[model samples]
Target: MTSTAATTEATEKWSGQLRANGRRVTKQRLAVLTAVEHLPHAVADDVAAAVRGDLPDISLQSVYVVLADLTEIGLLRKIEPPHSPARYETRVDDNHHHAICTSCGRIEDVDCAVGHAPCLTPENTHGMTIEIADVLYRGTCADCAAQAS
Candidate 1:
């Protein structure tokens, strides 16, 4: 019903997924996943800081490694915005787009109006079968718009 509630739900799913994927549920992965779950589309550096707060010994490399592992196992989604560091999210498996703020480099998830992966129907197949599509809608966010005014 609320953003926080939605995030908590996602975290729970990741927790179970880690166990399902034979992961030991290490503190570093938990910390990083928690940070990313709490703040969807969070950059690795921000997640590293958050994880460090809970795990004083967790290094930035550890966070990045854990993110890569989780993504490999389908527990997390990694998003890369143009000219920005990669971000992580728990919301995967949806054919969704992203709205990127050109001014501040903030990213937000935007669900595809169409159904399923490769939601957009390409004008030409290009002689290949598309499994997924990454769409980034770039513009100034509302906050940036207000700041400019």
Candidate 2:
């Protein structure tokens, strides 16, 4: 497909997603979502930078608001690693986990290790039905390990 045709198709897809979530499509929203799609596991600052290419006036605060809204509406997944700013990703439809590098803070997706949603079964539920699980594994990444060695 032509570049213009592909752009139009992607825009329509993003618009459909926003409308499905009862959100009004705007340039900022479109830019932010597109940026996140291209940059998985991006922080708000990274999103803002990516967005500014298309929307030079967009603010970091606006990116944060958009990120929070997208996450609340299930359009995005927000993951927080210890001592690191929260990151956003478009992979929200499944029960996947993350692996964070202790040395460089790089994040990568880790599929559910064993079973389905709420992959890890806690010994106690406290009477609440579990729907999903958020897991974060921390270790030095290959690059970091190689550098150390």
Candidate 3:
């Protein structure tokens, strides 16, 4: 599908989701959602800049509010890496890990190796029922490695 068509469909889906959750659909929320969709793993400032292309007066606080609300309702995933600003993405439901480039700070999604959520099997549960697993792999990315060589 064309980019415009896909964006329209996504906006409609997000709008429906907001309504289903009893949240009012506002232009600011829609713009923030669209920005996150277009740029997965984006920081709040990045989202704000993208949203400004359509909403020149949107405040950074508003963007943060939208991000927090959407994340609370399960429409977005927020990843927080040590010493890095939090990032947001729309790929949810499946528990996936992440790979970080130690040299350049780029992040990418990594699917569970067993093809499902909570992919790891722990030998000792310690009576704790595990529901999700969060993993982060750190290494130099291809470009960074090439640059070093």
Best by lDDT: 3
Scored against the true structure, residue 141 in model 1 reaches a CA lDDT of 99
Write the residue-wise lDDT of candidate 2 on 1-149 in tens digits. 99899888989998999999999999988898899999999989999999999999888899999999988999889998899888999998889999999899899999998858989889999999998888999999999999999
Clashing pairs in 3: none
lDDT of 2: 0.92
In what order do the candidates fall by TM-score, top score first?
A: 2, 3, 1
Model 1, total clashes: 0
Which 10-residue window of candidate 3 scores lowest in summed lDDT? 113-122
Predictions: Cα RMSD each: 3.1, 1.3, 1.4
Which candidate would rank higher by TM-score, 1 or 2?
A: 2
lDDT of 3 by residue, 1-149 (tens): 99899988988998999999889999998999899988999999999999999999999999999999999998889999889999999998799999999999999999998987689978998999998788999999999999999
Per-residue lDDT tens digits for candidate 1, residues 50-139, read 888889888788888999999999888888887888888988878798999899888888988787788888889899998778899999
Can you give the lDDT of residue 4 in candidate 1?
A: 83
* TM-score result, candidate 2: 0.94
Candidate 2 backbone overlaps, count: 0
Q: Candidate 3, after superposition: displacement of residue 148 in Å?
A: 0.4
Tell me the spans in candidate 3 whose CA falls farther than 4 Å from its real position: 124-128
In candidate 2, residue 7 scores what lDDT?
A: 83
TM-score of every prediction relative to native: 0.85, 0.94, 0.93
